[model samples]
Target: MESAFSGHIYRQNGQGVTSILSRRVEGRLMWKQRIIGLHLRSKIDHSYLSQSQHADTKGKSVETALHSLVGHIEKANQYGDFTMVAFMDIEGAFNNVDPMADVEAL
Candidate 1:
């Protein structure tokens, strides 16, 4: 098993202003003929930290969420059973995600 953490910077505005920061930590395990990969991300949450009283609150929330997700993935990796394969593909991971629509009468 191997794990790595990486940081990335992106320019949000057209004027080359880069204000947002993000990071990702990935873990992988190779067994026989297959590999299992897990990715965790850190993103800036502006909603909870905009006000003076809420400063640092967003960081705490994101940290907790990432911790919980990583724990769950670790548990699954320890208990899940599977056979080794030569190839794997993640289909419709990003493009298929849809936001919930309010279809009822408003």
Candidate 2:
């Protein structure tokens, strides 16, 4: 995904065009590098989690706890098979996900 543009002029009259071209090239390179890094990190994280015995046990425990909690809630609220559900949304959730910025700040 890396993109770059270069222009050579016989004279110095095309400074504006050169500047714009370099900026665009650099921007594309930055985006491509970011995407590659993200993909690599994701793959590494998935590998680590998949190979970890502790993660598997933790996941099972979490699922069991959630099932127990739901069962308890259902028993406590016996309304003839009718149940209620609540959902909440947080605004600017993605805006808070600056992983690099957070690492740099830390």
* Best-performing candidate as measured by TM-score: 2
In candidate 1, what are the lDDT values of residues 8-71, reduced to their tens digit? 5566677765634332222121231121111111233345343433213534565575565567
lDDT of 2 at 73: 73
Cα misplacement distance, residue 78 of candidate 2 (Å): 55
Writing each residue's lDDT as its tens digit, candidate 2 over 18-101 gives: 555556668997786677556545544354453223322435565675576588679867855655656455887644566565
Q: What lDDT, from 0 to 1, does candidate 1 have?
A: 0.40
Q: Determine the C-alpha RMSD for candidate 1 after optimal superposition of all C-alphas.
A: 20.3
Best-fitting candidate, scored by lDDT: 2
- Model 1 lDDT at residue 96: 43
Listed per candidate, the RMSD to the true structure in angstroms reads 20.3, 12.3
